[model samples]
Target: MTDTLLTEPDAGNASEALHEDRLWRDNGWTARVKKNEDDDGWAVEMIKDGEAEPALVGPWTMGRDKKNPKPLDTGAFNTLVKTASEVLRRHEQQLHAQLHKRMAVESGDATIEVTLDIVPDEDDPYALLTAFDSFGEQLAQVKVAPNFKLSRASAASWVENEFRRPG
Candidate 1:
């Protein structure tokens, strides 16, 4: 519930500068605690290396007096970084899943697997709807719009009909 400090002073600048208690930099991330503009409470922001914005921002706990914000420490910094990293990871996973869709349909005596993968290009966004036989051999590949949907019925119809390049 309390902030922990985990940074060591730079070896070269041992006596040149003094470290501040509110800001901490360590383990490829920085944790900073500041007063929240929306209320009298405090907020903590955790930023990873080479990133412009903080990966995580949330309310911070109060100190013993219940007026000032709790101090930032090493333990708190590490926890914040871990949480932020996880959030970034999950977001990437969800986005990847959203861009790729897959299904299988019965076409004649054979089962064909259909996959729709969307390429989010800035100038020209498109999707690739591919069909594979039961043995994993690619049967057909066609380009479609990014908003294209691939379902069992669509797959069955696609297999029933001849494979044509979608316009």
Candidate 2:
């Protein structure tokens, strides 16, 4: 739905995104070939737009003379973009796993699932501690510090305390 809000590419920047022998820019990604610092070989780096660092970098094949790096072709550029996009996706998934957690705590009458979802806000980072029953009904929810670590022991303690806000 939000795709409709995206603005068309600027004609003025068309020249900047054009492909070169050792550089290519498209699909919000830039692939640049440079000399590898470790050896006399070459390397290609793929950077996503608006990112300060390259998402992926690896060795590049040499030309016929075995001196310079091969030109960045459309096929190679597409492969680099795919690999870099996967890297970014995996990183995001790892971050999400680290920020969100869930545990089942046994109570007197039944089992309750407790979840902690962290909000890494720049100014006021926080987390939502929520409890749910087997039927998926939200029992309670409270805001807590972002650094709050959720564990089985803590979840049981929170349940014992009547789902109160934790420190």
lDDT winner among the candidates?
2
What RMSD, rounded to one decimal, does every model reach? 5.4, 7.1
What digit string (tens of lDDT, one per residue) describes model 2 on residues 31-74?
Answer: 77888899999888887777778899999999888997777788
- Residue pairs with clashing backbones, model 1: 4-73, 4-74, 5-73, 5-74, 6-74
Predicted structure 1: clash tally: 5
Compared with the true structure, the alpha-carbon lDDT of candidate 1 equals 0.78
How far does residue 47 in candidate 2 sit from its true spot (Å)?
1.3
Quickly count the clashes in candidate 2: 0
Q: In candidate 2, which residue pairs clash?
A: none
Tens-place lDDT per residue, model 1, 1-167, is: 43444343344543342224566766676677788899999898877666778889999999899998888766777788889999899988999999998998887788889999999999999999999989999999989888887777777777777667643
Query: What lDDT does each candidate get?
Result: 0.78, 0.84
Separate clash counts for every candidate: 5, 0
